[model samples]
Target: MDAIPFLPLDPLSILLLFVVGFIGGMVSGFIGSGGAFVLTPAMMSLGVPGVVAVASNMAHKFPKALVGAMKRARYGHVDVKLGIVLGIFAEGGVFAGKEIMTRLRAVYGDTGTDLYVSAIFVVVLAVVGGLVLRDALLNRSSRPAGTRQALPAAARWVRSVRIPGTMMRFKSMNNAEVSLLLVAPLGFATGLLAASIAVGGFVGVPAMIYLLGVPAIMATATELVVAFVMGLGGSLFYAWEGFVDIRLAMIILAGSLFGIQIGAIATTYVREQLVKLVMGMIMVVVLFSRLFKMPVYLADLGAVPALSPSLHGALDALSVATLALALLAGAGAILIALARGIAAHRRRHGMLEPAAVD
Candidate 1:
């Protein structure tokens, strides 16, 4: 068997890892879940095995999420009780999802397992992302003036149906009362995705904002809390198995700290409408990237060959290129948003200053 590559602790590798972590952290701070989506692939490209990449990423995520949650709490956006309840359920759900994944692997072997995961990624992103983009765009154009609007149809319906003994009111996020019926399912789905792909926030954040009567800011903030719970649990499990990679985790954490601080600071200056618009665009682009990856996995599983061998090779290359492009685009958008926010803050403060004495 090929020997596993030694832990890459070289200066260049560490620098590259730090940069990746910073970008990923910025994305996560803004969108709720982002570092693992790019960081895992980046680690694999750097010669880390897939499982180790995931374990190290999880280890890094716990502290980062804790820091982020604390920062966003300053903005009064975190729904602490709701996040804790959902996160606890999500913790259990992750184990269930892992059990399912193991069973699937046993039944179908490696190729089939890959195909199943890819299918889930494509389908879930397409449906959930499409809905989120639609809602964000529509809300951006037609939001009511002066006050926050009522929840979405899904949330309204969810709240209306009273499940005996499941109703709960959270003091945070404006004392919103909701049904655990809605939250548990969302939490479960979040856990399932997290276990399967290591980035449940994509699904979880949108679900909270667009389907569970939570504001976007609150949803994003609370997601960090949920991520912290899940990441902590996952890290412990991995550490017990000796898969926790401290060096990799530290490298990513170093960069993420600065990125997260910048992202949090920028949040104070941007209009909510613009945030929604940017989020909508991001969802659409990422959706297409996953869609492109689906066909390759399907072919691997012998489900269907949508392209010839040479064409498939080309498409695989295109998929990787597209993923990189998506990450770059997300990072670029984050930087632009941060810059604009800082400039706006400076201008506002500048306007408040008295004219210089002649």
Candidate 2:
């Protein structure tokens, strides 16, 4: 068997990883589930193999989620019961998704795995990003995505269904009973996405909000609960397979630990309309990044005619650069909001005891 491709990290790469992890932490803290979407792709951009990137990102995530969950819990944002039940099923999905990755790797090799991961990224981002963008555009400035409380038609329909043995209630859903059958598939998808691309929040948080009548803040916070479960479970399996690089996980986790708290705080201050806008744009931009990567991976797999070294290098650079810019774009919005929010809080409180409202 080929040696695990543990790329020797240089100073610049290590610094970049730290930066990515911090911003990713902010994303998770604020948005409730995503730093991994950016983190795994960023690591891959840094020459880590695709599986390794996902595995290491998983390793760093559980602790960050635990910490983030605790912080948000202080604000009464987390739904532990909902999170745990969904998370249990999500672990099963993680097992299946990781198994799929391993088999693909054993067959078509790293390039194949790269191609598969990039393909999933493109599809998921395109569909989800487009929907988010449309909602942001159509939504009134007065009512942000976060503050809208009335359930969508789908959620209402879901709530109306009464399965005798399968229904469960949640505070986030206003104590309405939702079916475990529905919850299982959603949890499975979240786990699969997390294992495949190192992100479940992209799928989980949004699903909770739009599909299950969850409030956006609660959905995001509760996703941290689900994330904690999946991250810990997935990390064990990845580590057993020798896919994790502990050093990389630690460096990234160290930076993200601080960033996640800042991000979680920003959620209280920042408006969700802007978050939705930036999030949609980031996904769309990253769609292009994966698109740029596909041909390169295809050529390597001999699924396409070979390209000149110059062309291959150019494509690779484009994919990495695009991924960086997309992630940075999202982080920039959060950071700017964080700065403004903090300033406003100090101005209003004058460093005295802060008020009780967001």
- Model 2 whole-model lDDT (C-alpha atoms): 0.87
The Cα error of candidate 1 at residue 68, in Å, is: 0.7
Clashes of 1: 0
* Model 1 agreement with the true structure over 1-358: per-residue lDDT tens digits: 2222336588898888898898788777887774576676566546565456666787899899999989989988788888888888888767765556555655655445445555665676667667767766777678775567676787777667787888888764356567787788888878767766566787888788767767777787888999898888877765665656888998899999888877666667665655555555555565555556567667766778666888777766665676667667777877788888788788877877754432
Clashing pairs in 1: none
Pairs clashing in candidate 2? none
Q: What is candidate 2's CA lDDT for residue 305?
A: 100
Q: lDDT tens string, model 2, 1-358?
A: 4568887988998898899899888888988884887888888888888888889999999999999999999999899999999999999999998998888888988878888889999999888888877776677454645455457888998888888999899998989999999899999999998998888887897799789988778888999999999999999989988999998999999989989988898888866666667667777888888899899889989999999999999998998899889878888888898899989988878646554543
Name the runs in model 1 displaced over 4 angstroms. Answer: 1-14, 41-52, 103-114, 144-147, 238-247, 293-313, 355-358
RMSD in Å for all candidates: 3.6, 3.1
